[model samples]
Target: MVRRHWINLNGMWDYLITDSRILPWQFYKSEYFPFDGQILVPFSPEAPLSQVKRQLLPDETLWYSRTIQLPENCLNTESQRLLLHFGAVDQICSVYINRKFVTYHKGGYLPFTTDITDFITEDLTVSILISVHDFSDTSYHARGKQQLKRGGMFYTAQSGIWQTVWMEIVPNKYIRDVRVTPDWDNSLVRMRIRVSSASSAENASPAHISPTAADQTDSQGTVLAFSPDRQNSSNVICKVYPPVFLEADGLNDTLCQDEITTAAIRPGKGATLSIPENMQKSWTPKEPWLYPYSLEYGKDRILGYFALRKCDVQIADDNYPRFFLNNQPYFQSGVLDQGYWPDGLYTAPSDEALIYDIRAMKDLGFNMLRKHGKIETDRWYFHCDRMGMLVWQDMPNGGSSYHHWFVTYLATLLNWMRIPVKDLHARLLSRTDEFGRQEYIDDIRDMVRTLYNHPSIVTWVPFNEGWGQFSTKKVTDFIHRLDPSRLVDSASGWFDQGCGDINSLHYYFLGLPVPESDRVLALSEFGGYSLRLPEHSACKNIYGYKKFTTSEALTDSFSRLMENTIVPSVKKGYSATVFTQLSDIEEETNGLITYDRKKIKMNPLIVQKWNTKLKKSLHS
Candidate 1:
């Protein structure tokens, strides 16, 4: 039996609005800002659910205050590490507990936790204060598809706590962080653990997710046997006490990793298990098998999992390049999943909603999904890994304004002209503001570290369509060095920097792009065929390459476009195709699913059949 409990800290909470500082006791004792509004947790106020439904202006501060109660047994342990987690707080955030300033975190799309066990006492009436400032298109911060003025493709701004907020108590000595690196050539998952401080008396229990299913034609492999709590890792946790750093300088990455000699008593400094040939069942859309495990460091224990799969750029017999999985040619059929919801802006409405998208896409024969621009919560990646889906995760782009003509128009024309853009892109994006350049580097690293473990992620796209593009060659190589495990799409669209794993392309307002002879060509983005169902559309203002009123016509046009353009391009070396989107966002109506998630646009079986043939043709 599994232990599970999550008190939904969602729903309505008494909201008190104030600009200046007033004693908490003073406000509650009398009537204040009578203009009340209901704001949904895990969803920013800019979203529909947040009754205020307004943007977080660049120059203005949006303050939010809410009180929460701890789970029944959470505060019972006096010696435990009581941690509070925030999925995300855009731009910046300052946290408070029971009127006491506890910690502050500064990344828009990363998870952060603080130990409030000591300050927290009695019946858990905790006051959380978060302040956010988002400069969607005004400043150089990572703002994916969030437009303050809102038009075309960009929608709305998501600020302050758009993901779950909960409390968990860990034993003094516990597993702080787990990094699993899978070595396919060696047939093992190299495990690394970050433990709490040495003085912490808590125990550490380590474990791994073991797959039960055996590959009939190949030999089955096992992970290294985990050992009990021992000591710590060589890495150190930078922030020892309250008020964590506003922005962690990459300066702290390795140097701050505390030196811990005592960890698990396992014999393997690294472990290797044998994977029998042919008996191995490589992860795929049809059958997704996952192995979940747990680990302990001191008294702290962490749960995690992984999948068996491999991807790389290999030259095919016909002399063009392609992505190979397990040494076999596999066409990456994907959908452009813009991580958004009618209720939750950057956040998914629920975990089930995230899983629904992944499973639904898999059922439709899509083996891959390009996590477009926006970064999704960990739960989303976990689902993709467990379900055996391929992923091309994009690094959210943020920099000075795009060169409108070069990025939107001229670059698209360059795609038609068959011109390379490494030199051109470098020159264009180099002129961006200093803050923009710094933030891009900061967010990309955070993005990679956050999703490093999930087996489903196979590609890292640094920039998209020339937005915030810079040092194309160097950035591509840098990511390759940071994580050599996956492919790197240096530039994903019209900005064709001659770097990265494959020659990524995006075609809209036109037919399928022609594959080049030198590299593996991928229709990374295209087919933004739209269907406007007034009942389910996110907003009345619509946008797409083309729009259809009926599903039959949409499906027919999609199938015909693929049969003539995309299918033929694959044979000619175009390795993958990620359709416009997964769901109809505010203005984008080109998703196979609707914004309301009420219906599926195309027949799953039909789409599956087409995808099956597409894969087979590539290998054939």
Candidate 2:
């Protein structure tokens, strides 16, 4: 998600929240009105990181206003486009540039953009106004685990902008997008480039440019006609330069960059390019190699990088379905990461804060993390890619209230017997609403498309413990069609349709199961042992599968669990294991590290020793 010519519009903004339910037509006139107060950008109002720490109620509508000045020599005149990008905005969002409506988006977790070149004059500064409406738990939006009434397992709801806001100046005829996939078996790196249209916005109407005071009352909202002026791009030239790598011995290597490949491609249509086998370097957790690339087309040039690797499931020497990376059988010793912060609910405080979690987990000698139930910012996956950590990404769950008697209590009992419920039973799975079900499908596709390039993501979990789960087998096939590059966990914990790359399960109070299925056996969730330190916990409401008193005792229990259950299970066909979690969250005081990120609950050295031994035992 990184680009060369961009501005970070994340700092301060005028904010207001009212239960008045202001209509979009009133926005143009309200721009001149004063806001109630100022709040920090990219942090939800409910989060502590945002200066305005207040709950954004479902009945309230939030508005944000900010002014920005474009720097000199920033926009590419030939490309004739100024792209305004928002990292994310909760639920429904409407964006305006200088009183004129620019664009609108519905999803909460994905990014959106608008081309404002026609509306923006040669003068630098421009006004930006954003409106957001979030109905947490009141509606069937794909909010992860946020609830109106926060408590155990569910957290306080956050709304509005909770991620970075930025603007990128791209050439009118720039490379719109690129998809890179590794063909390790053929020793090649395949790339699909999407080129932007060559048309300019010069003839756009100016009547709506600066709307009159009389025009402000229009209920239909200002209509600014702007769409991608796509051009015939089949004849554009694309140049691919060989990758350059940093040396380990304090010496830089330039030999790799001497080779280059050039080709002609269509700008509007999809075109393919390949890096020769000899020039590619394979990527892995032990040696995370990134091949730096530079792509040039017409008046546009972009610099990016990609890793060469492959993920699959195959029978190993021991006759167990093993997870394979780069055509080699490897064990994914992982921990479940919920990815929530005490100060910043969904958003990390800073980029370094995101890196800290990934680096700390890798330092624990674990290779993978099952990102439980929620999707993280793109930078989180970027860090995992460069820091040599594998990831199992989960699509955030959303649906109606669960039928506790059937979906919760009875489901848990049936899980013990390794039985799966009829996933199509909409009521039991919390997917009774048809609109909510379709929205889930759409969100998963968008999630996959957005995170496809990250090498760290090896598996996609569509259903976890049957929360909002429906149409398991069909959904599994749909995901495979989206991207066959990675494995799919059809059902992570329960309601297993027996369709997917792995036979995934969850166990808390007893020993792990050794399933004799045709698929890879994965203990997706286990070992939620809790040890509450008064100084480190958020509250006295201690919750976990098992409770302990001291760090010493916790470490002792963790070591014994690995030695007696996990290690032997690997030999008995358990290909992957995800310990309950990486860090404590709210009342769930069962993590290797405390929630505030101040203390390591377990002895790092002892945990590291056991983890290393466990990894080595996978091969034995």
Candidate 3:
């Protein structure tokens, strides 16, 4: 659980890249003596924003060291525990506090935490050392779109702390996790709050939430205490702070107490909250309303928000499956957003930089963005939630090598021929390692858990173009069970399992795609009209499906594509359509915007007019 009180450990830190493999205590010793230099936190060493702008190879290990002084109030008592949270650390990592080993973790994209209460001393100022080893494409880890050799489509590999690092103080027994699921059909939100016990002994007795746990004011709330007299265990008590509603004004600074109601939180259990009739607001792209809530356990309070919305695929009046938002037909006109930057490869330069990308797309009249093959910082999703943008999240691809003949040309040919190829062979899909397949499952589950709260995320693409396609039915069921609320495109572009919600397709040179299945039809990817502005380009050798020298030519082609292809497809039961991209990356000059984001390659007026036409046609 995230708390209101925490330190943002995202500034400069002492960094060192070493060829030697040393133990955690060796950093404090004479070996690997002085730190090489300083690097910015949250940005990978390979990124320009980081001072240490160099990649750490597979053989070398990256080290980060910093001295942090705790505030006077953090874990002031013996009954409190200080938790250190890492938003993400690439590959494998180990942490040490004051030269003592704290914890170790694996995987690159998921967040992890360890309790540092026992590691702290009387001085309060503690030394932190993190050792990171990322094998990049060499190992079976989930490195989203990161390649050792940077080029078109693939990007530069990065390691070490590539995301936010922070620490929060909480009571020994506090709220560990809270999951809120919005039920639009019932007009109620189901909330499940999990509490952790402070008991240290394994044989200690268990406890349960009292029957009188809900609707009890602070005065009437029963304060549960941990097992006292245990060696290191102190009497940790908790107070149930009633949940309150706040206006969805971005940060939820305004309170909406007129329609406010409270529910009882059972210890080690879940609770349900019914939306007040006066405050029931369905979240839509037209009117996105977020219900901000703060659930507190003892002194630790964490802010959370939820939206009442749902996306489903159902048969329309035309006898074809159509996408519905809040039980009403909604067309998903989206752009492909490869969340990359000129300064930061995977990471955005700043929080505002992330906001700008989403805002830019929304301003252009597109309602959704397919985050291609990479997950983003939590704040990015928050902006989408507050600013009214939908997202179709893609799981990062990993495996040996994709079958060019089968996945590319042959698959495309078969798609044109309307022949469904059962792409289960490991070699065909590039999935050779059994361990890697398991890791992919684990990582995808973690990704779902991490981003489940955002209402903007309505769809999950497990395998795109059969890059690492394996066990399609199993994986698709797994993702569906993870968040039954969201739609899952099991096999997005090719190798359709015919299991998921949509029959997704990708067409590049072909004139827009038409519905070929009884299920919801989606042109998942199309229209790669490229305009390379040399001044704004990142690389010299530009690549795209179609190239245009002039902005006028590009805009005209895009306008024609939308008018003749996309708009007509909508009338032919095309429920959703995602254009090739929002911005260019590396050598792929196919974005509507330039790679550096300095200029929009197409005319805004033309693009907006095209989008307006598409929306009007779909709505009509």
Of 1 and 3, the candidate ranking higher by TM-score: 3
In angstroms, give how far residue 185 of model 2 lies from its true place.
0.4
In model 2, state the lDDT of residue 94. 85
Whole-model lDDT, candidate 1? 0.68
lDDT tens readout by residue for model 3, 22-50: 75455476556578889999899998998
Candidate 2, run of 10 with poorest lDDT = 223-232
Model 1 TM-score, all chains together: 0.83
**Candidate 1 local lDDT, residue 509:** 64
Q: Report lDDT (CA) for all predictions.
A: 0.68, 0.78, 0.78
Q: Which parts of model 2 are misplaced by more than 4 Å?
A: 24-32, 71-79, 121-124, 198-256, 259-262, 268-278
Candidate 2 residue-wise lDDT at 610: 84
Q: Candidate 3, TM-score vs. the true structure? A: 0.90
Per-candidate RMSD, Å: 9.2, 9.4, 5.4
